[model samples]
Target: MSGEFNLIEKYFVDQQAQRSDVVLAAGDDCALVSAPVGSLIAISTDTLVAGTHFLASANPRWVAHKALASNISDLAAMGATPAWVSFALTMPEIDEIWLAPFCEGFFALADQYGLQLIGGDTTKGPLSLTLTVQGLVPQGEALLRSGAQVGDGIYVTGLLGDSQAGLDVILDKSNATKPFASELEKRHYLSTPRTQVGEALRGIASAAIDISDGVISDLGHILKRSGVGAQVEVEQLPLSQPLLEFVGSSPQAQQYALTSGEEYELCFTVPDSREDAMWQALQDIDCQITRIGTINDDDKLRLTLDGQDLAWQLSGYDHFKTN
Candidate 1:
């Protein structure tokens, strides 16, 4: 097996997606990246374990893709433009075959966002990946969870619950034969971070967060931070065609839409004054946006279906909670 430095040099160094703001990149003690004048640096890191995050038999390419994309999603939620990333990879053994496709997946998404790989480390361990992504946003203009105000419309970008349904398919938890098996699997492994949508929402959205821990859990973040409450219309939750086909409009689908994690869609609030401007700003964004609820003064979250209260017993994914 190749040594750590040799593997790093071979797989990660001198890769594509170089940025002019990066003063120094990989192969250094530490990376040096510059933030443009009047801009603030946004940083977020995520760790993905082999069994807990992805199946042990999962493809290395998709694993790398998910690891990096999830972290970038955090930056997007802050309405930042992704600029650079540093990742640490731990493996049971240095298998060049696995390392080969992993870099392919990592750099493929990096190139898409023009992200420069600044620095990272390689170690031998229980097969895990951690990526730290950095982005730039205008000072005093970064969207935040605490900015939501009472009466602001709660909105979400793209279809929700697909990632959870895809996980069910991956784990063989789905009872019925799934016709859109590949589509669901793709949604699970290839969740797209709403970077462009986040950029469009910079000035329009009062508060924003990426839906990694399901809608209820993530939106709860905004509510808690803003010291406000929200009432989400269950009927207004967006369901993709594959998810609708998989489970129809039943409560099961609704539950998934409410509590499924790793969706990576942007859930944001728009002040009533900017509601029209918000629509116009996001009209040309690739993903669709839905107004599913409104902020309130009560400081609690409520759910309703067709103007009637809907009871939900399930909670979002929790890493330390014992069943």
Candidate 2:
């Protein structure tokens, strides 16, 4: 091992969790993986930067957890089975204390989903983590943003706004005083990718997206791609009691659900006829699935509360925007 590779193998590779799909793991020119027969590989990459993705001084373990979860969530969105991951981890300093816990967090999530750690780079730089996750889906069966249609039922897994509520606690210590504050913070930091539920959704959901960028914004991707519109019932949005206590009002709860980002829940569409199948698909997963809306003919997004159109005009999270 080169000096850098030595550092990586010691701190990362030797500690990695294993998988059945990886033919080759770390300490190689390239890692090889086997896609299951009759399955196509799905790949996605995600990056988390300090001060943006997490607080600069956030716990290293949670940072690592969120990084891996972000990529894992993408696989879930596509109805794929996660198999392997290659990490590109950059750090400003080599703190074994921090790296050890980070590795623990990374492997915890990996082991849960049977994700293998392949080969990747390690370097000294700003604190950042990028993971490329590979998953498998039966050929021609991946859920997509363009599959939604008029009369499709709109749904999301898990409650919305928790991550944003978590962010509120992180950004402002005062929020930590709220009820269930630690729970909210943990929700943002410890991502739970709905891998099983997503795989089960194949052939049942016409369109799907992981809610990384908030419901309206990410679901809008489905609307635009499928050439359809959506009408959401604000009163029907699934909000956790903790989130309700954290945000403190219907309006605030609605704003968080509609605009805040990085919750990693799946938002999907099913043809009206598949609603029962949708329920059957999720029976095995331990998640709260809620139908919030229906796909419509026109390309105009609208939300209604108490049978009246809500004139809310907030766009969801924009990565490169300044106001």
What are the RMSD figures for all models against the true structure? Answer: 2.2, 2.0
Residue pairs that clash (backbone atoms under 3 angstroms), model 2: none
- Candidate 2 yields a Cα-based lDDT of 0.85
lDDT per residue for candidate 2 within 1-323, as digits (tens), equals: 12243565676675554566777786668888777789999999988887778766778889888999989999999999988888887787778888888888888888888887887888888988789999999998899999998999999988898888888788778989998999999998887898888899999999999999889999889999999999999888989899888888978888898876888999999997888988887987899999899999977878999779999888767532321
Which parts of model 2 are misplaced by more than 4 Å? 1-5, 318-323
lDDT of 1 at 195: 92
For model 2, give the 10-residue run with minimal summed lDDT.
1-10
lDDT at residue 273 of model 2 (Cα atoms): 88
Per-model CA lDDT versus the true structure: 0.86, 0.85
Candidate 2 positional error at 149, Å: 0.9
